[model samples]
Target chain A: MSTRFSPILICGAATLFSACESSTTTGGGVSDAQSSDAQSSDAQASDTQASDSGDGSSDGDDGGLQDASAEDVVDGDDVYAAEDALPSDDVPVVAEDVQARTDIEFPSDVDEDSVTDTESPDITETDVPGVDAGGPDVDFADVDPGDVDPGDVDPGDVVPGDFDPGDDVQTTKGPQLGEPCDLSIQTWCGDEAVPTLSCEYIEAEWVWTEYNENGLPCFCHPASSPGPAICAVPGFVGIDQSGRDRQAPSLRALRRAARLV
Target chain B: MADALTIDFDRSGIIDPVFAHFAIPVPTLDVPPLSGVVRDAAVRIWVDRARSEYVGVMIVRKLHGLLVDLNAPMDLQELALRMLLDEQRHANLCSAVVGALGGDSGVTFDVPELQQPRSAATLESQLIEMLVGTYACGEVVAHTLLRHVVKALPKSGFRLVLQSIAKDEVLHARFGPTLLASIRAGEQASWIDCPGDAVISALYSAQCRWMLGRDVVDARDVRLFEDDEQARAMCSVGVSEPRAFKAAYMAAVERVRRHARSR
Candidate 1:
């Protein structure tokens, strides 16, 4: 998907530049033919140079590739033609990315948008993914609701083999002791963009999402949403009537899980 | 495997979760590898202590519920709640002690018997059984056992917590007498004639018998009445004291039996 979008971004930048040049030339002494001929030739030369320089190195002066790497430049994007490409017409990319990158943990008692936790150890400050279980300082990272196993006693429950990275994210085996992988996303390099996904232990509760349909409550991703309902972990197998997912285990069940009985 | 009752409480949201309050501090023992002897003893001690404290909490809570059940005025109810809360605090303290010594200290219970009306006639007998058989008999006896632990365990935070819990139990025992007097006054207590004497003596005897059965208590340790060296030690056979607790208890039992027989 990312590879297909690259060429379209470059073309859009070029179009914007041409429009500005044409508008400026209209107010100057240069004839429309001369002005358009010069700009068109310049654009062609830049495009040709970009294609020849192996992943747009010659067109490196174009700030479009400023954040992307050489292999991911315009040459990589050439796989998608301009006709097949669509421009990023003020599509609120930054906002969506911020929203999509919802895997980060937030403060327990703060607003969803306020990313900093005054009393907590900041997620960005720690390189180690999960809570430093043995650290002097306890950091309760927002657990991934799917990874919780309070009574993970059975050896057969071990997540099979080492984790493999792929597109289909689903669980094939239950969790077990010391199984060092996330089951929801079939990945191994551990989503560098969102390190929380690959932690050894994630303790999260079930959360309901606004988009739930069929009147069935759904466990929501903490990364994309923030509400009291977002972190309420549901029990073994029950959902609330309002269609909002419930994570509050029955008091009796909680006691059993805690080994109080 | 975790107990089912604990699971039920975990789900009910009635009591706060164990992790919310208890703190497990560093352990002081020099436990060796695969040394099941030391580890097993430690684990046993922890389990026993947790079990003991749990009964205490259950008793106090049940007693509190009973006070409310009897429709005893507000003053009596308030007194019972205070005692119940004290018992909970003791449970919490014991839980912290167990955790500090590297034991999992959550309290779990099975789903309670189905909720029947509070006014059921059988409730009184059940209350009597729980109080005489479980609390006074079970928990008070546990205190006798833990008295040995306080001495055997090396001086540390765990011992300190045990001491605190024991002190609370001493006060808790007084509740029996107060409630017993009230039951006698109301004539609602189960046993006919000298019911208070019968219940108190039975509980005291049952407690002694149960404590002695735990295998930890040695007969040579009975020191509540004697001046012998073994008697001075914490694990002494204080339960066998001839002239002190047992004498008073036996006399009370004889009185209740005579009254019942004459009637």
Candidate 2:
């Protein structure tokens, strides 16, 4: 009957967008005019600290995307950066060390309608990975359901011991990283961990197989790890089954401890 | 059957071996017999989702364009592209669902162009609109709805397609507010107050109309089968749950509000 919120949902909620600390170049606002301020802000890095200096200068700092250094991503979703302090009824909160973002400025004077179109950045093309074979029969491999072992789950085995789900909900057991499963299962590993670790299927490895197969494996991951934390399945059913925001705070942790950042 | 459009989508190209650790597993469909009303209803849901996913693509493309035009952070722009790719793949998956149901993909492909909010005044307004509508509200709602649908699925490939699609939306949903914060950083003005934000409300209403196929005036006007008797009947087969989808929509919108710190 305890109604405690998970630290991940409470502290890392707004920052689920990304992981790691990167150099950010700001150039936007309600107006179409671009700001000339070339000053760059270092994206938030490390843990669940939403580092707000309280000056309101660097107000909404963070979005530290998942970087190559997985070592920095100790707290799953917080890997991106610290989010604004969220409204939690009662929970453990991470300290946000936000610096002043005073340097990045927006254009106060904007020529809305008459503005020249800014040349869109050409992001390097990643090789599209789907439907390429276009063969008579789809390329999905048959899944071996027997490969999944519930005994291998036991969230304690996958998630770090520090995290607490906050609410009264008991920690649910599920398949571990590389353990065969199907659509019927999602990221169920760290339903009770901080900075939320997901125990679900990885998207990149998803392949079709003979019908009614459950060949996919589950892993612990952050609810939303930037870059490639084994892209989460379609969505998370890891949280509350009723779909209540308060109840489903069990974001993601990791599929396997070693694979992703 | 020859006239039916091909909607089955499968990933076959070389998957980067680097990501093999802790890779997500997929399920296969146990093809079910298609007939009468049940089959028809399943087709309608997948077709409708296909349209939404298609629009999701257009919206992200436009959003990427806006980011480019505004000279937003390169990282933000890149995230937009990532979302675009995800939506494209998702569209293919939805097509696969339609094909499995023995339906036409064109029914979804033929839908209208993505519409911009009439209240948007500039590229900036438009960008925020995309963040709120597409990522914030739409993705958030879809994430929750897919969770339920995945459980209801009859241990078939239908479940695999949906579950896979659902996971991608988590980051997309979180990206909504993160991008918004990046845009509105240090500024006290709330983007939720923008006139274009009203469009988000209209979108929810529009979804109800599409699902129920009529104007929704009040609670009494809801005609979708929410009763438990039909729970396993229609919803079990790929159709959306009226109450669950709406609740998720409301929850997503609230998350946006909290993120904006407007309350």
Candidate 3:
């Protein structure tokens, strides 16, 4: 959040058009073009921040403009790279970054219709694990659910924690990332402290066995499952069954906790 | 079917019960259904899960609605249609899935009641026009939560479906800013001002902390923002730049605030 860099919605715009190629290659081209784009993006970043800065130049001082390092200038997406900040050994190696760092110049003039607007003509191909398998069955064994620590076990699983109908509850299953969840197939795991009862169970016992047949791992909370999986976590239902049922309040509380609200 | 409880509404109805029924847990795995005190715990857990999904659906629907329909330069209109189709399918799929889980289908849109009828020619009068504060705040929360869901879910048959959905969203998040920038460009020179940014910032701040709590295990562990391929594909989308995404959100909020204040 603190990084100071130009803000442009890169999506194939500058990349496909080759608009800035001339600016970066010519003498002082890189700085001029970058500085100009920086100014444009900065102005758009926020009216408030731009106003407060008095002069937008205050932001460029943060080291975004330092000579390019091993990191390739990822054109469209404005990646946040600390100026002169040495690349870490662990981050995944990018093909673009292989080149040695240099003080490359960018184009000074803005050509709206330039070919650089859209980078490469075709979308780049990248590899995804299990995407190619294309098999009907999922490779569950390939997934590493990671080490589950017992210390952080939630008590709500064992005993519904202090239930407050009006209290805002956070749901673990909200559309947090970007996709919709098929609630029917979503697998539920009770809190580690109390692992019992789930939507899957209902399917297995009273409903359909297809849910259990899928054999998905249970990750009640987020930040656990990295692989493609639909995790269902059991929630607490308030005892009040009348008008303004406790379920509504309890559900609201979970959504609040998850920040889905 | 004998014990089924049905409730019908003449006007609009709240979706809490629909969500709660889905939240109720029945248990999975090879373990036998727990009885006595354990049974109590299990039931509680089940309800909570149902509740979470219920909340998640609402957020997803609203966020999707905002992102897919913004006016833009490129194939946004086409993209918007595609997104709407996808969302409508999603809504149908969600309804079917929830119904299968014993949850009732209680969702209904009353936009006609909320606003005066606007013809296709008067699209500008639409009440649901993407509001900057709502879009920024909802999506801030949505992006973070979806990321967490993606990380939390593992590879399984069900997960495959989720993965497909998540993959689609990665693209959706990419445009959040491009659309905002377009709006900002138009508003900067216009007579009508944009929205105040502070409200959007406040919403984003809340969403950020909420995301941290949901995704982060300890202070040391930073959840990978994007998986290897997701990161690459997202990076390629030029619009997927998080920095620009942030800027777009900020600018949008400012425009909304300004516009609202002027109104």
**lDDT, candidate 1, A1-261, per-residue tens:** 111112122222222224323312211221221111111101111111112232111212211111122121111222211111111221112232222121112123223222111000000111111111121211112222223322232222233444334323322122222344322221111111111122222354222112211111111111111110111111000111111111222443443444553
- lDDT by residue (B217-245, candidate 1, tens digit) is 11222222255432232112111222232
Candidate 2 has an lDDT of: 0.34
* RMSD (Å) of each candidate, 1 decimal: 37.0, 25.7, 25.0
DockQ of each: 0.01, 0.02, 0.02
Per-residue lDDT of model 2, residues B1-263, tens digit only: 01011222444555775333212222234455544556765666665566557556655656666778767767666666656655665676676667767775354121112221111136565455456445544454455455434433443345446644644554464565444434434331432223332333332222211111111011211243655545455545555455554443333333323332221
Off by over 4 Å in 3: A1-261, B1-81, B99-133, B186-193, B196-263
TM-score, prediction 1: 0.33
Model 3 accuracy (lDDT, Cα)? 0.24
- Choose the strongest candidate by DockQ: 3
Flag regions of model 2 displaced more than 4 Å: A1-261, B1-28, B108-120, B151-154, B187-236, B247-262
Kindly indicate the candidate among 1 and 3 with the higher DockQ.
Answer: 3
State every prediction's TM-score relative to the real structure: 0.33, 0.40, 0.28
Better model by TM-score: candidate 1 vs candidate 2: 2
Interface RMSD of 2: 22.9
Instruction: Tell me which of candidates 2 and 3 scores higher on DockQ.
Output: 3
For model 1 the local lDDT of residue A152 reads 30
